[model samples]
Target: MRKALAEVGQTYDVVVLGAGAGGMSATVFAALEGMRVLLVERTEYLGGTTAFSAATTWIPLTRHSRAIGADDSREKVSGFLDRAVGNRSPKVLREAFLAAGPEVVETLENKTDVHFRPRPFHPDYLYELEGATSFGRALEPTPFEAGELGADLALIRPPIPEFTILGGMMIDRDDIGHLMKMGKSLKSAVYSARLIGRYYLGKMRHGRDPRLLMGNALIGRMLLTAKKLGVDILTETETTAFVTDKNGVTGVTLRQKGIDKRITVTGGVVLASGGFSRHPKMRTEKLPHPAPEFSPSAPGHTGALHDLAFAAGAHHGTTSAQPCFWAPVSHRRRPDGSMAVFPHFVFDRSKPGIISVGRDGRRFVNESTSYHQFVSAMYATNKDGSHVPTYLIADAKALKTYGMGMIRPGGANIKPYLADGYLTEGATLDELARKLGIDANGLKDSVSRMNAYAKTGVDADFARGTTVYEKANGDPTHGPNPTLGALETAPYYAVKLWPGDIGSAMGLVGDENTRLLREDGSVIEGLYACGNDLQSIMGGVYPGPGITVGPAIVFGAIAARHAAQRAAAARRGEAGQGEAA
Candidate 1:
């Protein structure tokens, strides 16, 4: 139903679709190799799901680890991958990812504005897994100032507003310690003052402060590096279909501003559209019933590249038992009629005095496990969606100390939350149960049992505070048990949680070279995929923090290098023909 309004005959050495971490990384790498590159994005702003992320990259046995005094080896990481990813993982792909990951980081940091540091205390999601380490495998981007981006700052998508403070001020894990005690301690007060002062100063210069951190920082640096390397970036351009010859894919037909145009590519096309998380048809086919309502992914993500690749004869990869990486999300509808969905990762769950319960008013999970593990329990217990609205119950003291969902710590006013219907409050356990439509007697008995556990600093029912992973997420200062506390306060509170997915698990089939493959296992020359578009190397299991972005960056590098070499070879062949002529 659309018409071609124009055609672009310019042949780029490499054309990258989507501007997420993967696509951006590929563009930067290819440009660094002197390839005539073109980067296109469906959205006006760049940085797909990655911008809203914590921006941690889980890369094992890297130079960063070595610098941090970690003694990890490739063999150990491989053993861990084998045990964690199981038979569903491709051995060659896994090996390639691990091998290329450290190199990618080294090159990026050595050549461009991209920078990272080891998270010395960060642990794998399943720390107890074979060969898993307690630290040094994860790396986070160095925080970047928005002013360094200049005019391009507006084009970098900011972190989720729900993750920010006082409107748009972004803070990282290090800022939490100071913020939690800002009012009580002088040093914390000075730290908070300095942060606020910097934020306001930036606001005075730019309409919004450009003090980018986390995922935004990673993408901001990538964009700047790409620009410096002379990569042409086209925003609001949709790649509708691939232009293929008998030999292989040669270019792409793009629809931009409602006008279709064809752009030739001599190098290759990289598919990194942040997966099919938002596509209705794909959601129907790949996800469970009652499609997920909230995703931390960029709004532009709708699996367009996947559809286009499939139309071009690319085969679907083997599906995972788990089609998506899961997380529990809690939302509050704002006065502007927009809902703010917050993914509960490391903040509130493992904190003392909080428990998650189902419709039957009983604890269904440990409530201190990894987000993926917690959501898995949610699915197993609430089959058929009977527990449409699960509640996270906590007492007044807990709410004041730890906060719930979007509520910040340090005694934030809860009256507004209650008035907006975001929180259910009751003076007593019975009152709260009645309001939440749960069995009052069952909730009472559950609370009594949890209180007993709190007294002894032990969770006999679901082992809430047993694992090192749980304790790591907990408040170490809390006495008795850092993650266990009695709910014996007068006022109790509850917030509803819904199952949400952070990334897709299934995608186009690809080989160790990041080349897309056909049904017969033949490679599609000049076509590559990475990020969520390539079936995750870990299959369905979430091995550790930054797994998604870590492999995304590595394959992005792989795809770019391979395409650049191929294009150079083709150019040489053409030059040879000219000499013969």
Candidate 2:
């Protein structure tokens, strides 16, 4: 049962800060080990950014891999990481994550409600890497029934409004494909009808669709498991400071409902508070110069707990290639007078008939590349901040077929978007360039070159669809090149893209056991870190989908098991002292 801060006990075997994927995993695993665990979330909703993600967990060589006949092994995965990440992160940490990843998956499946199924053909972003595979490395959570949570369903952080359709109907990739073919295929029509029917039926009762998919499903399952394990959950509670002594962190001071309380922890305090992505000072300090004005990351990642961790001697990792994960995002004002920031991840960019260009009206990056790499290319090419707000242009056919940024597919009604200036439209290429304040001659020349490349079925400039990963994201039905098509259709459209970070990469350094380390490389006795709180194992290199969540789960479980062992040792020592006295 959920407990108010006042109702919770004075002490717990484990007190986990943050209710994100990492923190919740630590709480669930600790409780499964017969320990009393308390999960604290600064926000009223749980899940943090995980709930906003697709929840593609990239853990290789598990039972799910075997079931899917994926020929992946530790050696292959390690080689891929070595080539992709080099020595940006510690080898020991990566090795630890690989060793514990499968174990975490197995334990969660056997002991909790958390479950994942292998993605059939999801390719790694860097498919050209030495040991990158085409499938089975990434696992996605199974769809869950939100009704199972009863009234507590509201506690799971809602998906972004832009990600849903028809007033809160969440759909996954498969659903998208089926919905796109709804009128063309009988099978798809039936499938989409049932899906939409169920959504409407559920929304009538719950005010939101009861079917949960993607990150929502993962979090819902974890929340149900936490409830089953009797893990005490306190939401909207702020951890003001870590209560420490000579031995290190022993408790935490919390403020809930404006009432302050200190709770003792016997096992350990696990820090999984997302990261410092939203911290006002840390954003200016850690993020790149000309810091992004907006981010789509969860609001709970304000670095409040990071300050406490820093005071306790924990320091952030510095060897990462980038301090934060990047995504190209577009923003629009909602009816409620709030800004809706949508991260453009694998939606319309890789599809045919689209091209991204800088102020000079010239292409700078491969349009079919991964979102992270695309934004990285933007930064690399944006010496004068011209590429910071690059334009993604698509012709009429492409706009109606694939959609662009915040605009939905089918192009049924775009007047609102145009009237609001969320989308810029032009009847001709020259007109589009003029409206966007770009060199019209350069845009016309770029389009001409793109047309030739489309006819030849090759992108000589950037190789947009050469890799398996790129092709997979592109329209496979398109001939010549899956990701290449001439933007010759009249009535073009464009949306401004901004570099938006989804999560932090640089975080408090921790050991293989998830124990937070001081600046001198010594462990902080009773403090541990996981999720974005710990330095990313991939060294800020986005190797594949779910790279962050994969390590988060592994290290979160590792931290809990280590804490359980420490609690056992402490009990033994106390008993020994009692007997001696």
Candidate 3:
């Protein structure tokens, strides 16, 4: 207690690793409670991947929505989580996050300058699917003035440009329905345009630079809260390990360039340094596939913290590393040295893409459920050594639409892919079948039956034409089953699909309380991990829109508060012991 109190500025009450969603919320809450905090990040920015994330946070119901009359309840939230993440999470870990998420949401809204608004348009994935709810109880960060953050803004990353935003001309989901409901009315259109126009004019009037994209809005909002709280956000500093004495964690070691330095912090460390999804060796050994599809996680996602926590004697669990829930991107390069990937734009029967086949050149599983399901099934035959490249059979339409985004329409950038024979097109299914090395008869039989079902909006085999989500999301013009249009139109195409992963979601197992455990299931002292470094509580499945993020924030806060409590208790004990001695 004498040493800890003497360590003041040299050691904080809490040291949080990583500046991601969980870390951000944890630091803010800890600082507000009057705990001295230090947040370390390896990037030049805060937000981690959250800045560029989908900006959609999934909570069954939030105070903001409830205030606006949305029918949401904690009971419903608990029931949904039970069905979703289930027993995969530690009971303590689950309860802590579930209980704290709503409070965190409400706290950020009222106490901070953050702009959090309920997203009325955000849908729970498969919401319209049988047994799903229509009202998506979620919130998004309102567009922010990126410049108000000052130099702290340097610690923030930008959002992906392709997505919709209020500052830009693109139409978002929230506006699409309003436009259709008020279609062709000049007053409505003008009014909508004016609302958007007002935001831009407002930003310029405030003398603030704007990066008001959807995901950026959330990043911008949180950073505002962080700045107001005066929390020190140290970026471009790499954390090599957790420092500890026999008592508990003492501080952290940080590296800049090649120079090494040790900082003693009295506050316990929060290990929010994400997962090993982007790690090279982990990618090679544990992931099902050989590659990644445009993960937004920064380049620094090595297995450092996973290894750090393990070295610090954190208990291992589930005995596996799982792939991220991702959408497969059919990617191609543009002239600007940028790669444009269209997510889950696989070709249907009417369109052209590689014919996705099982090892026997047979189709299995509805290919469009979610990319998580798609990639998992892509490697289903790996144990038998028969699955290599899952073939993509496409015609001209597939080539035209697949890799052509982010380039000028009819531009010369596509000439190389076509010239190098990366894309194949043919008039006959037999020749295309031969090119894909499929059994001609089997391909024919499969196509014939699939076409028959396409004519009637039915998938007799795997029930592919089942959901309106599929129909609305797919090519609606294809008719019948938009997902099952006939490939008889000719100009066939094929590309082999590789088993790929976005990142890993598995790691040191913890109970729902967010405590790091030892190998024998005993809890480790003064250690905590959240975000990807912690084994996912969701069992590596996509249960909602912002699964990784919401819990990350929830558990991150839970860990920080608990760590502070532990520190306070230790200080009290030490003072008492000293007096008695």
Best by lDDT: 2
Better of 1 and 3 by TM-score: 1
Return the TM-score for candidate 2, rounded to 2 decimals: 0.98
Model 3 ranges with Cα > 4 A deviation: 1-9, 64-77, 115-131, 160-209, 289-296, 319-323, 333-361, 382-388, 391-423, 430-446, 465-472, 475-484, 488-490, 493-497, 570-581
- Return the clash pairs for model 1, or none: 146-210
- Model 3 lDDT tens row, 283-394: 6666655455455345556777777777778854563324565554455554677754444533332232323564455676565455566666666655454445555554
Question: Which candidate comes out best when scored by TM-score?
Answer: 2
Provide the TM-score for each candidate, comma-separated: 0.96, 0.98, 0.80
lDDT of 1 by residue, 291-349 (tens): 67877567877987888788778976674657788889988877789777889997888
Against the correct fold, how does model 3 do in TM-score?
0.80
When sorted by lDDT, best at the front, the candidate numbers are 2, 1, 3
lDDT (C-alpha) at residue 247 in model 3: 49
Query: Tens-digit lDDT track for model 2 on 162-199?
Result: 99999889999889989989999999999999999999
Of 2 and 3, the candidate ranking higher by TM-score: 2
